[model samples]
Target: MTLSSKLSAARAGLFRSLGLMFIAGFGATVAFDAWGQIVSPALGFANLSPHGLAKSLLGAYGLPNSDFAGYFVHFYLVGLIGYPLGWLFVFRPVWGRVVRRGGWLLGAAAYGFGLWILAIGGITALAGLPFFLNFTGITWVALVGHVLYGVVLVAVMRAFGGR
Candidate 1:
């Protein structure tokens, strides 16, 4: 293929990859809701869901929000950014093999680290915003949740790759 054709092909492939990854991510959200929203409350983990998870996972960068709209907006931004990140994190390894066999794990860890940093950075940048700035617990919540996200991503990558 000519360079232009190759670029077009690559773009198409990226779109496809992002679509698949987005679906996977949405599923992750649902699974998270199932446990945090449903099971957690039942198990007395009422406040141990995303709120806690984001704070813990995000660490210093973790911005905390209490309003449902705020929560969705924050995650919406994360999901949007995460779509492209999936390409950097997963595509090269699974498709190009640019990384080693453990690329998935590394990718996941990097992603977790990214979110952790985002938690602190996002909060700091938006500290003036009343919605999330007040929620000091965002650190713990994001930290824990992103850890779970990283862990699950690693598992899914392994399982899917194995299959």
Candidate 2:
């Protein structure tokens, strides 16, 4: 192919990958929120409010502590962009290299577990909360929710022909 044609194809592939990531991320985030906010509460579990953590973080930084701000940060910034990009650029690639014969599901699960550590262990500390939320029930719930997020993310990506 000509140089210009190769560059055009590369650009197209980049956009396609990004589009897949965005859609998969949005879907996985919905699954995570549904479990944490709706299903868990109905099943007599604590209703997780991840946005609350975002609100606290915002307030700590002298930003507005409104629900809108919290939800925007949690859903849009982290869910749609951060986590998906992590999977696309970091976890998936590393897993592919480290475990050549490993299944994608397991890799995705591991990624989810890492996300839990990042959020519960790391982000909570940044927000001035106990690491892993002091290992409370909500901590386990968040773990499950994050794992579900990863599974759903990869599943959606695969369903749409992503590697």
Candidate 3:
């Protein structure tokens, strides 16, 4: 193939990965949100709800605190940060080389851990929030949510031809 054709292919691949990441990220966010709203509350975990993170992050930006604001910020994070992460890290080097060959679930599970670290450890620290939340139940719930997010993200991305 010509250089121009190769460049075109590369661009197409990038867009493809990005598109897959976008859809999968949204789905994962929905799953996490559902868990937070329904399951977490039933399980008596208050801090696991999305509102706290949304309120804190939006409040830092001088935005009015509301459920709508929180949900908006939550979706924005999932799309902008989470999706790109899956594209750059999970689907690129991690999935094909390590996960696909032997154990897809293991790889996806590991990706979930990475996501938790990025979201909880990195983002919380950046937002000046404590990494270890006061509510241990919330932390555990969040970890479980992140793992579920990773699994769903990988499955959706693969379904969308991200592999």
lDDT of 1 by residue, 20-73 (tens): 556556555554455546665566543334433344434434555445535564
What are the runs in model 2 whose C-alpha is more than 4 Å off?
none
By summed lDDT, the worst window of 10 consecutive residues in model 3 runs over 79-88
Q: Candidate 3: which stretches are off by over 4 Å?
A: 43-47, 61-69, 79-87, 90-102
TM-score of each: 0.54, 0.96, 0.76
* C-alpha lDDT of all candidate models, in order: 0.52, 0.93, 0.72
Best by lDDT: 2
Kindly provide the TM-score of model 3 when superposed on the true structure, using C-alpha atoms.
Answer: 0.76
Residues 1-163 of candidate 2: C-alpha lDDT, one tens digit per residue? 9999999999999999989989999999999999999998899887899999999888888999899999999999999999999999999999999998879899989999999999999889888889889898799889999999999999999999999
What is the lDDT, from 0 to 100, of the residue 100 in candidate 1? Answer: 60
**Which of the two candidates, 2 or 3, achieves a greater TM-score against the reference?**
2
Off by over 4 Å in 1: 46-72, 83-103, 106-110, 120-125, 128-141, 154-163
Q: Is candidate 2 or candidate 3 better by lDDT?
A: 2
